[model samples]
Target: SGAVHFTRNNLSAYIRSNVRYLVALLVAGFDPSSGPELHYIDPFGSSVPIRYGGHGSGINFCTPIFEEFYKPTLDKRTAYNIIQKCVAEIQKRLVINLRNFDVFVIGREGITKLDPINQVSLRAQLMGNPPPRK
Candidate 1:
């Protein structure tokens, strides 16, 4: 797919030209001919297509969760649950306190934004407890 190749190449070139800047990205799309696609472009210009990937400070925490739960044919609800778990684990284990996350889905119909999930509330919900007092 030329579009996919072009996107990766363009990001690689951009990262190369802007060495001083941090430019990590997760590029996801739905190609009419190929279905869903996901790519991760790192700060060093290296890019690779992935079934599931995470970036930034919380990536290390999130990757294992994705690896354990990700399925190629997972349902939307199940996928959302995995993401919530990832955010929750990040909040719990990562030194940095990252709380809010914006979620979106790319499919045959195009991109759809889902409700933002808060790590604190999600963590409590997953634990079968109430949200922590502020």
Candidate 2:
């Protein structure tokens, strides 16, 4: 009934209400009282706190991995690794060609785009087309 619920509820509702909110969001940011927080909002309007989540065709391929490995206190590097794995699995399993992907993180400062995944990289890593430098 205070700051926490208000902020959480507002975010959930806003996400659901958006016209093209057909995608899933792995959202992380800070709340005035709660500090750093993470949530997964799906196309179906369910917003949930989670250490890991995925959506669309990727969910079917990557959720089991998250189920086995997700931890509440994920370090920054580990979180990036998990996302990469999800991308790889999705690209490998799905026929759809994903051209690019963006990774965003919301921290004390604000939302920042960390790094991006490209088609070339995905093909190299997951499709066995050719390897990128490790």
Candidate 3:
């Protein structure tokens, strides 16, 4: 919670100083005493706790997928699979192309980084399209 407040303050100060840029931040982690935490910090530095959230241009595309699929008790494999599904949906639906993504898992053990996913490749797999030629 302190971290979230600090981030909100920093963002608020930055926006106050620069007035020309808008940015939102997502802070997520695993807390030992409390389990999982996800906070969406808006451009004005207002922070809201959320179970599942997305930021920036892809939020519209990703949020619905998350809402439809997210479960608090998801296992690692299921969570990763849902992430892939979200990415695939975004690639297919969004106007701008996003090529790759880095995935991390925050859990009881701590943050675990996974192999990055190439959105094009994953989209092809999800959609039954041919893979990019090697």
Model 2 spans > 4 angstroms off? 1-27, 40-47, 122-134
Better candidate number, 1 or 3, judged by lDDT:
3
| Tens-digit per-residue lDDT, 12-121, candidate 3 | 88877855447777898877789889998887889999998876677788888889889989987677777787877777788987888888887788788875667555
What is the TM-score of candidate 3? 0.78
- TM-score order of candidates, top first: 3, 1, 2
Position 15, candidate 1: lDDT: 62
Q: Considering only N, C-alpha and C atoms within 3 Å, which residue pairs clash in candidate 2?
A: none
**Candidate 1 structure quality by residue, lDDT tens digits, 1-73:** 4555776677667666744556778778888887898987776657778999876778898888889999899
Q: If the candidates were sorted by their lDDT against the true structure, best first, what order would they fall in?
A: 3, 1, 2
Model 3 RMSD vs true structure: 4.5
- Alpha-carbon lDDT, every model: 0.76, 0.66, 0.78
Error of 1 at 22 (Å): 5.0
lDDT of 1: 0.76
Q: Lowest-lDDT window of 10 residues in candidate 3? A: 125-134
